[model samples]
Target chain A: MGELYRLRRKIEQIIKDGNLDEHQTKGKITLECGLLLALINENTPDEVNALRKLKTAAEKLLGNF
Target chain B: MKMNSLKLKLISLVMACMLANALIIAWLLLDSFQREKNTLAWQALQGAQETYVHLEENCTRTLSATLAALLADEKIAALYQQRDRDKLYRYTAPLFEILKNDFQVTHWYFLEPETAAPAIAQKCFLRVHNAALYGDVVNRVTYKNAVQTKTFSSGKELGKTAFALRVVHPYYHQGTLIGYMELGQEIDEFLSTMQKMTGDAFALIIDKRYLDQTEWKNVRNRKNLPQNWDDMKDAVLINDVLPNKEITRFEGEIEKIPAAGQILEEKQLGKSLYMKGILPVYDAAQRKVGGILILHDITKINSNMKRTLLYSAVSIFVLTLVLGGLIVFVLNRLVFKRLDQMNQTAIRVVGGDYNTKIVPTADDELGQFETLFEQFRNVFVNAVSGIENAESKTIKTKRPVKKRKPRRKP
Candidate 1:
């Protein structure tokens, strides 16, 4: 429960900051980042796997630009 | 000029290529025309020089033949040896009329070898003007040289626009040189004939020393000349200089070729083009005696070339514009339109509409991409529907039901 709460706080902070990368700290939350946050809120192993896949997709999207 | 749409970008690319091609073609066309003009200029100069030589040759041939006829006349030789002036006039009266009126012989003077006085002198024009008609001629030295060698010689007459051929022969009275009889023929008649033959103006430029004589200046004062004739000391314009009536282009950039013995140049004025060539004349002693300037009008050819270039440029510009428009239309309809539709479908699928169908129109790479995207959408739709069904069944199973055994205990 404590780890879940800490992960929720981190996700909220990431969403509020609208950025996940260390150097990138500005801009609105992307659809990919929003999808990742929604998967993390599910709190299930399958959803966590989906979150990991979405994180990879977000990284790929950033790399494309 | 902006790369905003695919249609715009494609049209711009094609138009740019077309414009570049048109410019290159125009440049090549202009270069070819320039080369052609250069070649024509050279040929024109050559033709003018040939015409001048032809005139000179015609004069020489006619004078040579006339001199031969005169030498063959036994009565003239007898009259010269006797120095009979009145009898000589009676003997040569009809022959002189025939020579002057029929043959354009301007001057005829028979010089006696021992004296400076002419044994018999006759002229076509009764003006009694120049010394060539008399014995005090500026080319008397040339005449004496011809007599000494007993050969035919041709030279330009001073104080006149005439080129004279002097043929001095020894009249014999039983194997003795009695006196020298000389014949002189001027060039006005030959020049008029040449002008009639060729449609070009001719000018005979003499040395300044010839025109510097008092008699020559007095004669020139009667003729029409430019106001600055005296200042134009480079080449003395003769009295019979052909007027530049048709020449609209008279730019004073006559190129002087010292080695070629001719000055050749072309000029463009308004819509017309004119070519001028000056062939230098040399005497038998290889001295630069004078020049013959010929003007040829080549305006028709120049205008034809200009019209061709203008037509080609206009045609090319219109063709390029039409071709560029056609290219843009084809690309927009066949390729870009399809691409735009596919993009919209992809955006809808990205917004979670997993049932978005992509209809491919061709077998190219784009078509293959569209097919793969449709398959991905199908799989995503099936997976999402299956997940929803499974979750509903799990929720039904987790719902607690009231136990029936608790009612029996009550």
Candidate 2:
């Protein structure tokens, strides 16, 4: 529902499609975004920096930036 | 630079190797220089010893020739045979003075030959230098040898406070043995002459065992020299041709010097550096009685060596820096920069820029790797494009009723 949750779901889908490890892919994105994906729920506020960080992390991990 | 990057590791390895090589070269150079300096000091010691021997030989030869000429004078032989002390002294004192002044001859002697009475045999008939001292039994090896062999004998002899090169010839009158004529020179003159010849300092250290301390003290006092009889443990400094008397203070056994000589360590005396050595001094009986300490000034040579080492170190540092810079530059050009280019291109391709290619700068191994990577990128891009096209076509086919509606609309 939230923009952060949408970005997280898109990353999860890319990882599943690529048959990549879920925890490792999330960990890499978390490291890149400097935020924990497990804590980012649908009700979480979509801050501008958080959204930009999530988009950049997803683009870096999945190569669609 | 990244800590674990290949470029950093390669650069670190190169620097370490260069440092190690420079250290090894410096050590080798220093060792070689030290060995060469030591060899030069050893040669100087040997040369000084040889010069001493040569001077002794020349002094002995001159004394022998002079003694022979004096023995040829029938009057001198006749005066010794007559036991005329006053006339002999008057005749030879001026000659002794000339010999002392011109030839550095210090002692002159006339001795009674071996007779049936042992009390009178080898008695000092006359000492040309000292008319007050006479009738003392001459018990020296050279005198005994000349009396026994009845021929010319010459050798180095140690006296109460001095060493001298003595030459003895059996005096004969009308083919009958009369007495002995001897000419002598003090060996201290050799040290001074050798110093002049080689510009090196020298000291004669006689063993205390061969010397009486009272007589040594008395001689030192008589000569107005320092009464240093108790200065050394087993040896006394008899004479030295040194600018500083302190340089003659050695703390080693004179008799322990090797026959060929012993090279001592370099020492810094005042502002100058010196290389010291010792040549064993043997009396006529071939007994090691003393040692000749030789000191050669090596300050200039030592400074030169240090300067050379400093230059070498600076040169190595500069060369290492230059070489390191060149190697780093070449490696960055040939490998690091190109690898970085390949990494950026790979990252761009992963980010959907498939048209971006890896262009190799050289036809080396990295270039070959770049070509293979480009081929793999081409294959991957074509496969992805084909999959995308297939998926679109499948989506169009799967429209079914929508496709029929689309055909009705058309």
Best candidate (score: DockQ): 2
> Total clashing residue pairs per candidate?
0, 0
Most TM-score-accurate candidate: 2
TM-score of 1: 0.69
- In candidate 1 chain B, what residue range of length 10 has the lowest lDDT sum? B120-129
What is the DockQ for all candidates, taken in turn? 0.06, 0.07
Write candidate 1's Cα lDDT for B11-69 as tens digits. 77888899999999999989998777767666655776676668777766777778768
User: Which lDDT tens digits does candidate 2 get at residues B1-410?
Assistant: 99998989999999999999999999999999889888988888889988998998888888888888998998777777767789888988898889899988889888888862687777988889888999898889999899878888888888888888899989888888888888888888788899989899999998888887788788888889878888788888888888777777778777678888988878788889998888999988889998888899999988999999999999999999999999999999999888888766655454345677887667999999999988987996787566656756665675556334445554
Candidate 2 chain B minimal-lDDT segment of 10 residues = B401-410
Q: Which stretches of candidate 1 lie over 4 Å from their true place?
A: A1-65, B1-10, B84-94, B112-150, B155-180, B189-191, B207-210, B222-228, B231-233, B239-255, B258-273, B365-410
Off by over 4 Å in 2: A1-65, B392-410
